[model samples]
Each structure stands twice: as structure tokens, then as C-alpha cells.
Target: MNSEHTKTALVLGALSGLRTLSATAVLSHYLRYNSNLKIKNRRLKFLNSAGFALLSKLLATGEIAIDKSPNIPDRVRPGGLSGRTLSGALVGAAIYSINKRRIWKGALIGATSALAATFLSFYTRKQITRNTRIPDQVIGTVEDVIAVGGSVAVLEGDR
Candidate 1:
């Protein structure tokens, strides 16, 4: 693999780890309190891993697209939603974890990041596919996955 693909894979792996952990936390909370999903801890863990893998694949694809495509958005641009989502997730999670006592507070920050990420994915998708009229399949797939993940994160609420 090229350096760009390597970097993409690394970032996706990291994001996958993060997503799995966060999903575990979210699912654990639900099972502990709600008792509705009938989901076992083991199942939750599995789901977390699966969700993370899906996210990682999409993100990895997007990263590769960035290197291969001419129309990739610049990170510094005002409307660079993909960058905002990626950076926001990292910063939001970090800030939240700093004071782990108030999980709700941290969750709120995460929710905000997720919301922003959703918008970013949508914007990036539209922009990336604009000129070509026919989006690269990989790019399109990443955008879709990001959009779905972002929405799910938001719906899960301040977890």
C-alpha cells in the first residue's frame, strides 16, 4: 500500500477503536438502566466491534479518495465538513474524558461533535460529487457511512 493508504488505514484503525469503546459505553449504559434491548454484554461488545469496523472501512476509503482524487476538499477551507468531523470527534472526546466524573457533560460534547459530523458528511458528499456528476464509489460509500454513523451517534443522545 502507498503511504497515503497506510496513513488512512492507521487513522481508520484508531477511529474504529474509539467507536467501539464509545459504543460499548453507550450500550452498557442502556443495558444497565433501560433493560429493553435484552442485549447481553458480550453482544454489545460484538456490536461495538462491528460498528467500528464499518466506520473504519468507510473512513479508510475516504482517506484513500483524498489522495487519489483531484477534487478533495482542503482541510482549512471554511466548509470542510470532513475535517471538522474528524477533528471534532477527537477534540470532543478528549475534552469529555478529561473530566470523566460527569459523563452526561462529556456526552453532550460528543453529541455536538456528532451533529457537526453529520452535517460535514452531508456537505462533503455533495461537494465531492459535484463536478464529476458521477461520484467515485468509494467516496460515496464513505460519505454515506459517515452520515449514518453521525446520525446514530446523535440519536443515541448524550451517552
Candidate 2:
């Protein structure tokens, strides 16, 4: 696989670690607008649909709002981690498929990156919150920006 494809998978996966739906939302939006793409997988065709794009964006926005709540479970929790991993895998596979490369490789890289980033980001956020005494909501907002901005950068850079 090309290094650029691998890099995109890794970055999107890491962003998924921060917000499970963010990468998929951005990717769906990208796919929706870029009509020249020729994705062969029928299952992935939904990524190009306006309805799917809208739904993913709404879900991502909801995730962002709920993420700021103290009652929300840690992202490293089994359920959260699994969702993020799946999100990473989906987007990674989509990226590779769009590039006419092997989707499995991208899925593997994306899932692994998401798994690693989940723990790393969790601890890093905890440390920053503990050390700086800043509200977690503020940190989470910053993380949202990173996830959203990073997703956009990775996908747009590929063009």
C-alpha cells in the first residue's frame, strides 16, 4: 500500500480514538461531494449518499455534546473502544477502497491506531486535566477541534 494511504488511515484512526463518529462523519462528507470517486464496493456506496452524510454529521455532533458530560464513560471502556475501532476500520477501508488499494490493510492499520490512540489520548487528557486543573469540558472541546480538523486535513491532503 502507498505510504500516503497508510498515513491517512492512521490519522483518521487516531482521530476516531478521540471521537468515534468524527472521522466517519468527515469522510462521508468528503465522499458525498467528490463525485468523481469510483468506489466498487456496493456496501460502501452509502458513504457517498447525502442522507448518510447528514446522519453521520448529526451523530458526530451529538457525540461531541455528550462527550463534555462528566457522566460519560471513559473512551477506553470496552464499549467506547470497540465503537471507535469499528469507526476507524470503516473509514480506513473506505479510504483504501476509494484509492483502489486493499481495504484489509487499511482496516488493520486504522483499528490498531485507534486502539493505541484511545489509551494514549485518555491518559494524556487525564494528565493535562490533573496538572493544569482546567475543566475537562475545555479539554474535550480542544480534542473535538483536533479530531475534526485532523480528519479534514488528512482527507483533503489526499486530493
Best by lDDT: 2
lDDT of candidate 2 over 1-159, digit per residue (tens): 589988999999889999999999999998878776546577788888889999999999999999989999999989999999999898888888888888888888889889899999999999999999799899999999999999999988988
Candidate 1 per-residue C-alpha lDDT over 108-152 given as tens digits, one digit per residue, 9 for 90 to 100: 444454444445544665677886666556675555354335434
TM-score of 1: 0.32
Clashing pairs in 1: none
Clashes of each: 0, 0
- In model 1, the number of clashes is 0
Model 2: lDDT equals 0.90
* Candidate 1 lDDT for residue 13: 24
Q: Each prediction's TM-score against the native? A: 0.32, 0.96
Model 2 lDDT at residue 91: 85
